[model samples]
Target: MSLSGETIRKIREAIKSAFPNRDELVMMLRMELDIPESEVPDGSNYNLVVFNLIDQLDRQNRIPELIKGALNERPGNPDVQKVAQEINAIYSNLSDKPLLKSFEFDVVTVNAQGWKISRKRCRAQYFTEDLGNGVTLEMVAIPGGTFMMGAPKNEKDSFDYERPQHEVTVQPFFMGRYPVTQAQWRAVAALPQVNKELKPNPSYFKGDDRPVEQISWYDALEFCARLNFTINVTTQRDYRLPSEAEWEYACRAGTTTPFYFGETITTDLANYRGNSTYGNAPQGEYREETTTVGRFPPNAFGLYDLHGNVWEWCADTWHKNYEGAPKDGSAWINDNDNPILRGGSWGNLPVLCRSAFRFYDSWAERDSHDDLIGFRVVCAFGRT
Candidate 1:
């Protein structure tokens, strides 16, 4: 590898000190420049020698203030000067004036998997891309394991479509922590796509922090396309909607129940109807619109709004039964282009809000932004 600017500059200085003639020093360093970094032992000696030089010059009372003044003129040059001063102080405190031997040191470093730091150099790295605005998207670390994916057919409010409870193994995937917001949508809308359309002035009921509604399945797909491009996730695995099984599995966090909270759901538990005393107990506010995401408690898996707040978009095509559904958690195909939507909306009654409930919408139709239709995102791991 090529030498860093700091290393190259030091070699130039060393050559100057040894040869005295600038032309001869330049020729020597040019020859040495091709040497591999691994072959350079005492690579750190450059810093130690500079520190020692500053100490010697100061002790001799021969420090040229002109040189110090020139260094001070550069903006960040004080950092170097500060280290030089620290070295001089250490020299004065030591029994012997050997800067390297006299200095005491301790270094600590912490790193994640596949990365490490040694001395002043870092060894391994994986790129992290900023999704946009103030948000950054990083790879989520999920260990490979089996999770109970679908609800049983006999469960309360269970639909035939959720039948054939299966154990699916998800091999470590990354997902967006929050539902896609208006700002993220606009970020994608700015891209060039004729079929990709968005609200002229996208409005969230609560705010941009509230999940962006009023987007169609087609529009959401386009947004994912731009998002995939923005973060450079694999184009082969498009960031489409999550399947019914994946959504429930993530929402449940490995629990088997009618609601993640338990058999009954309350306003305190989720943002659903609470005021009307139904078959359960006391009722809550008769809110006609969707509440802000994360307004209530999250499930065991740290997923928010899986119960209420708003209905989320699913990738599967609508199906009346799960008799022949994919056991591997892939989306089941719907007639023509109709896609399945899941998680009952805010306006929905208590019976409709059950986790097993299934809904469908035409892919071409746009979301009403009625504060009842919001969305989350899913991405295949290692691919995108």
Candidate 2:
């Protein structure tokens, strides 16, 4: 093992005190250490020299007795005992430190050209979580950036709530590739509670990869809390729901269009109603029921089902507009109903599936949940 420079210096001092003549000390230590002449440097390799001397002294089995004698002569003299401790510490550290390991994975993204799978670490674009129990969650690494949030004026069927569009700066984080699937939700819900208990299979849909719906806003929070605990044990950090601004920022993925792919979205690109069309795009097929997660293409950030599939619950409370919204992407929590839903569901019109769309579940009926609304998870992570 390589010894610290300071440790080497202290070792040299010990050797010098033991033998005053440098040449004589070198000859004796070289023989005792069994170090070849080729390996010995004229002045350097003092660390090695010290290490061997300690080993030889230890083999002689006199260090403990020496410390005992010194303590009896002068309590805590820090002479022989201190030197022995330093030698022990240097050796101890060699066995204590563990080697670091590395891993690699892939993700998919969209651009002006089309969807492309990437294994490159270009934006540090990577997020793959295995929640265990036959349930794994895929996510995309969202690089932090500033963007103009909310639907623009003159947009088709844009609501007043989406009006007064404002800019938001979201920090880098990992967002689920799709809405929380039944399998993912069941796995998290089965974990031991942190603050509250949960029903393992709360979704109205019965499929594993299908999005988990019919869950209350409070239930979503509980699921996240359980997920936070589970992931924290694996990575020593927790997960959370994305703020409304963060959801919008990641959903846009650098696009100002109504959808991440373009000005209009179709069932081929998303899972929203197929009979209707938006912008100048042609009408397409609409599946009346929830489709499997990742049934369509992903956004530029490699996130799927952000525009449709299921309405994702955001951590923000219901707000009218961006008049006094937060600039940095953070949950705008209030005492009122604390859940804000975004991304249209399978039963909604294409207009409601716009990237800037927003909705909220009924607060008066906490237990109420429709088949149209479900949520995904987000976490502040990755090398920043």
Candidate 3:
């Protein structure tokens, strides 16, 4: 594909941002292109380094090869993969043959005692939504499946609200790869308001990559509404909060264990309070603050931070139990004013972070902002 000067400039800026470390840049260049160490530029000027590397790759007609190498080497780095996907989209637009894109990742599991059980490779398809100003949102395709949607009675720390361990059939849908980050929140907040006005910076921890907390359930709805309004013009897709069933099914990722990782969770796997341990798991560090999204391993479905970081708001209204929950993967709604919250938060215990754990705030407190609250988005299939 022939990249114009403007396209080249954008790619250079993206590459520089994705790889700011001089050593990492040189390592990628040497690993991808097999460039001799002496020939590579050495300096703190990442722009110059990226410029030379891109120039070399363009001259050799090996830009695509470099992108592939980056994807393979840094699958967890969303910025790198975002740049690759953007370039691939450009190539697809200009050529008859489109480049192959993959979302391969490593899935790890632990036993009841929190011991490592297994590790396997998995892959899923995803699409990127450009939110402008170099920030993008990644939505992974969750496969349709039938799974038990709640905690087993014998499970430790299981609650009545998570009881009845009934079966639920969830249809295929797309979900955010991580909890909504501050950068993503800001981008969508800047969009023309759909209902309520959003504060540009509402998070307490304060990092562009950290999950946007202090967001009420209503604020999350507005974010989705604005996003749908903006993207539906071109894609005709509806973006909204995930249903309670869909949230549990996606978080479990076809696992019956308390966590997608296995029987127990530790501070190493999630961002909950580390002073408390789940099952036989040992106590770990209490970071006392939110870490960047995707700082931990993802589930089998390629979704990250589903266990902790912040509680994710769901589309369902607060219910006492699964007595009359929906069998199909749709939100259970009624005249209730309170909304359901899932996935626990950084300040919660490991038990609260369990996959089947469910929580809700009072109707009077529904609009109140809590630093422990945030959300991710879901897009149904066939909307386009």
Q: Which candidate is the best by TM-score?
A: 3
Q: TM per model? A: 0.59, 0.67, 0.73
Question: Which residue pairs in candidate 1 collide?
Answer: 234-384, 274-283, 274-284, 275-283, 275-284, 276-283
Give each model's whole-structure lDDT: 0.51, 0.67, 0.81
Q: Which stretches of candidate 1 lie over 4 Å from their true place?
A: 1-129, 135-144, 147-150, 204-206, 233-238, 276-279, 361-371
Candidate with more favorable, higher lDDT: 1 or 2: 2
lDDT of 1 by residue, 304-360 (tens): 677776777777777666667676767777565666667676766655666666776
lDDT measured at residue 186 in model 2 versus the true structure, 0 to 100: 79
Q: Which pairs clash in model 2?
A: 274-285, 274-286
Residue-wise lDDT of candidate 2 within 1-384, one digit each (tens)? 454567556645655554445465555445444444554334556555555655554456533333222222232333433554554443333322112223232334333233332323323255467676567776566778999989889777899899689888888777777788888887877664555667777766679889999877778888876554434322323477889999999888887877776667766678888787776556677778899987776666667788777888887888777788899888887787546888888888888888888876454134457788888888774424
Model 3 is weakest, by summed lDDT over 10 consecutive residues, at 92-101
Clashes of 3: 0
Q: Regarding TM-score, does 1 or 2 come out ahead?
A: 2
Query: What does each candidate score in C-alpha RMSD?
Result: 18.9, 15.6, 12.3
Error in Å for residue 214 of model 1: 1.4
